[model samples]
Target: MNLYDLLARGFPADRSRPAFLLGDGGEVSYAELEAGAAQVAGHLLARGVRPGDRVGLQAEKSVEAVTIYLGALKAGAVFLPLNAAYTAAEVDYFVEDAEPAVFVTDPRSFLAEAQAAAPLAQAVPRADDDVASLIYTSGTTGRSKGAMLSHGNLAANAVALHRAWGFTPDDVLLHALPIFHVHGLFVALHCAFLSGAPMVWLPRFDDAQVIAGLARSTVMMGVPTFYSRLLANPQFTRERAQHMRLFISGSAPLLESTFAEFEERTGARILERYGMSEAVIITTNPLDGERIPGSVGYPLPGVELRIGGGEETGVIEIRGPSVFSGYWRMPEKTAEEFTADGFFKTGDVGRRDLDGRVWISGRAKDLIISGGYNVYPKEIELVLDELAGVTESAVVGVPHPDFGEGVVAVVIGAGDEASMIAECRRQLAPYKSPKRIVFVEDLPRNAMGKVQKNLLRDRYTDLFTAG
Candidate 1:
C-alpha cells in the first residue's frame, strides 16, 4: 500500500474532527483534508508530476500547503519540503539536484497548476519499498544528502509511535513547530492523523499563544527552544497546562536543566525523544515510565538500536523498516552507510545504559542543528573562505538557551566582523548564518592536521552560557 493508503486509515472515523485549527480561527476537518489533498494530487498530475518524480515545495505553513504534501503522496511524487528560511541560491542547489517536476511556492501557484485535473480522491496503491519523500540531511562531510523515506518506512514509524506514545482519538495536539522538518511534519502530523486527533495549529511558537492553547490541548511536541521559552515566561503557570497530558522535546538535544525545570513547574514530566531526518523517529522516553532527563529512553517498537560496543560512547546503528532505505541518487554513499551486519550507521555518538535507555553525547557529523534546522559548517566555511581577508574558517556549535546550539564561526583571517556576518546573511538562510564570528590567529589543530573542533568547543563553551 502507498503511504497515503496507510495515512487515511483513521480519517473516516473522525470525518468532522478538525485536522487543523488555523491561527486565524479557521479549521480544516479530516474530510476536508482528504478532499483538498485529492484535488491537489490531480493538480500535481496535471502539472506534469508523475509517479516517483519529486515535487519541490517551499512555502509558509498552512492547511493548503499540508494538503499539497498529501496530494504529492497520493500522486506518488516524492514530497521534498525545503526550509522556508533557505535563500534562492540555496534552493537552486536542491532543485537542480532533485530535478523536481513541479516547484510550488504559493497557494495560487499550487491551485493554478492543479486546476486542469479532477480530484484524485483515492489512494494510489504503492509497493511498501517505493519512495515516499526525499528529505535533505547534512552529514559530517558538510554537504547535504537527501534521505529516501519509503512508504513502509513512514507507515512503520507512525504505527510504532502511535503505540509507543499512547496516542488516542481524544488527544488534541498543540502544534507550533514548522511543517518543513520531520519532527513537525512527519512525526507530529502522522501520529495525529493515524490516531484521529485534532490539532490546534499556531503559525509559529509564540509563548503567549502556546500558554493560551495549553489549557485546551492534551499534547504538545516541541524543540527545547519551545519549552525553554515557555518556562521563561511568568504566565506559563501550572494551571494553564492542566489539560496538557504530554510534552515532547526533540530535533535538538533537550537540556537537563530545562527538563528538570519543566517537571518542577508543570507537576508533569516532559518526555524527551531522539531521532534524525535519516530515520523519522527511533527512541523515546516512555510515557508510562520514568521520563529521564538526558536519556532518550528505549527504542520504539520494531526499531533495533545498537551501539557499536565500546568502553566509551559509540556510534548508534539501527536496522528496521522505519529506517530510510538509501540516500537519493548516491548509491556508493548509501552502500557505505551500512555496516557488514546491515545496520544503518547513525553518525550520532550515543551510549546505552543498563536499563536499555540511550544517551546522546555528541554528533560524529560536523552539522549544527539550531532550532531544529541543519547547518553544515562546510557550507558556511566555503563562503567565508571566499572573502578577501579569510584564509580559512571553522564553524562549531556552542551551547544556547533557546536554539539548543548557537552557530559560531572562528575565522583564520582578519576581516571586519560585521562584513563577514553581513555576507553570510546575504548568502545563507538566517538559521544557517553564524550568530557569532570570532577572529582567531589559528584554529587548534591535531597532529594529523585535522582542526580540533572539540578543543574550540571547550574554549568557547561559555559563549552562550548565562552569567
Candidate 2:
C-alpha cells in the first residue's frame, strides 16, 4: 500500500472538485492534481528513479512543487525536500549526503519535462515499513541526520490529524507556509488532502495576501510569525478573520503574548501543536475543547507519551506509529536516540499535566526555533569559529516578539558584526544566521569548562523585547 493511495482514500467522489484555489482566482481540480502527479511519476520512472531511490527537490513554493511531492509518492520514491532558502553551499551538503537519484532545482522546467512523458496509470506498490521521505534535521554536533519516515508513519499521522482537526470537504485551507518543512509538507497538506478540501494557495506568508485569503478560507496553519505579523497590521481585525474556523500554529513555540493577542484580535484561540521532522505531529490542542495558551494539548490517538526520568518536567519521550523509523544510515545514532523500551527521546523539555495535556517549556538541546525554522547552535558556531579573527562563539536563542526566538551570537573575537553576519549568510540559510552579534572578552563557562549557553540566554533574555 502507498501513502498516496491512503491520502486518496478520503478524496471526494467527484474528481472535478477544486483542490487548489490559486491566488490569481484560478482553480486546480482534484482530477488535474491526479494527472499532474501521474505525469511526474511517469517522468521520474523514465529518468531512472527506482522505487526506493531518493528524489531531491529544492524549488520555490508552487503548485508544481506539491505535484512533485505527490509524484514521488506515486512512484514509490523517497521525497527529499530541501529548503528553497538554503544557500548553494548548504544545498551541496544535502546533495552530497542524500545522493538523490534525481535532484530538481527548477520546478517549472521539471514539470514541463514531466508533461512530455506518458502519465502513469497506477501508483507503484509499497510496504508499510518502506521509507517514504528523508527529512534532514541537524544534530547538536553540527551534522545533519536524515530521519527516514515510513509510509505507515505518514499515513498514520495524516489520519490522526485529519480526525483530530475535524477536516471536511467543506473546509478551505489558507495555505501560506513553505513546503520544505514538515509543518507545511506533511501536517498541513495531509489534512487538506485527506478531507479533499480546497487550499487558497499563497507562495509565502504575505500580510495582504493572507488577509485576502482569510476571507475565503476556513482554516489556516502557520508559524507564530504569521500570527504575530498579522496582528501587527490593523487590517487583521476580528471582522476580517470572523469567517475563519481554525488557526493552527506549530514548528515554533507560540508565545503566550501572541496567543492572547491573537485571541483578543480574532475572537479565536490559535491551536498549538507539537511536532518534529522525526514525527510529523505528536500532540495538539483539542479542536472541540479548550485551547489553553502555551499548552500543546494531548498526544494523538495511539501515541504513547511520557516525560523521560519520570519527573514532573523532563525530556519528552514518545512511542507511536507515526514516529519515524530511524535516522537513515545512522544505526548507532538512531539507537542512541531511542530508549531500550523503543520510545524516541524527543530532547525537548516538557511536562505532562495530570489531565494529560502537554506543555513544552524549552528544548534540552540548544535548538533555536527562529521564525519556525530549527537553527542548531553548533551549526552556526562552527561557521562562526571558522571565520577570520574569531576566537570562539556561542549561539543562543532569546525571546523575540516576531520570530518567537531571535538567534544571537556572543563572540570572543575581533571581527566586525556586519562582516561576520554577511559571511554567515553566504554559507547558511537566512533564518539560521544570527540576528545580532555581541563581542565579549570571554564566554561564561562551568567548572567543567563547557560553555554555559544558559547563562548567555539568561543575560540576553530581553535583548529583542527590551525598548
lDDT of 2 at 69: 96
User: How many angstroms is residue 35 displaced in model 1 relative to the true structure, after the best TM-score fit?
Assistant: 0.8
Whole-model lDDT per candidate? 0.84, 0.89
lDDT of 2 by residue, 1-467 (tens): 89999988877789999999998889999998898999999999999899999999999899999999999999999999998777899889899988899999998899899988998888999999999999998444558899999999999999999999999999999999888878888998999999999999999889999999998999999987788789889988899989889999988767676788788888999999999889989999999999988689999999999999978877899999999989988899999999999999988887888899998756777778899987767567768877877756788999999999999999987878898899999999999999999999988852212466778998999999999
Q: Give one digit per residue, the lDDT tens place, for model 1 in 1-467.
A: 88887888866475988888777778889998888788898887777778999998898887777888999999998999888878898899899889999888896566655666799967677898999999997433557799999999998999999888889988989998888878888999998988888899987889999898887789999987788789989999888887788999887766565687788898878888889888899999998988887789999888888887654566789999899989998999999989887899888777888888998765666567899986767567767777878756788999899999999999887979887899999999999898999998887752212467877887887999859
Instruction: Write out the backbone clash pairs for model 2.
Output: none
The parts of candidate 1 lying over 4 Å away from their true place are: 12-14, 112-116, 309-312, 366-467
TM-score, every prediction? 0.79, 0.80
Q: Mind sharing the TM-score for model 2?
A: 0.80
Highest-lDDT candidate: 2
For candidate 1, what is the lDDT?
A: 0.84
Q: Give the per-residue Cα lDDT of candidate 2 at 437.
A: 95
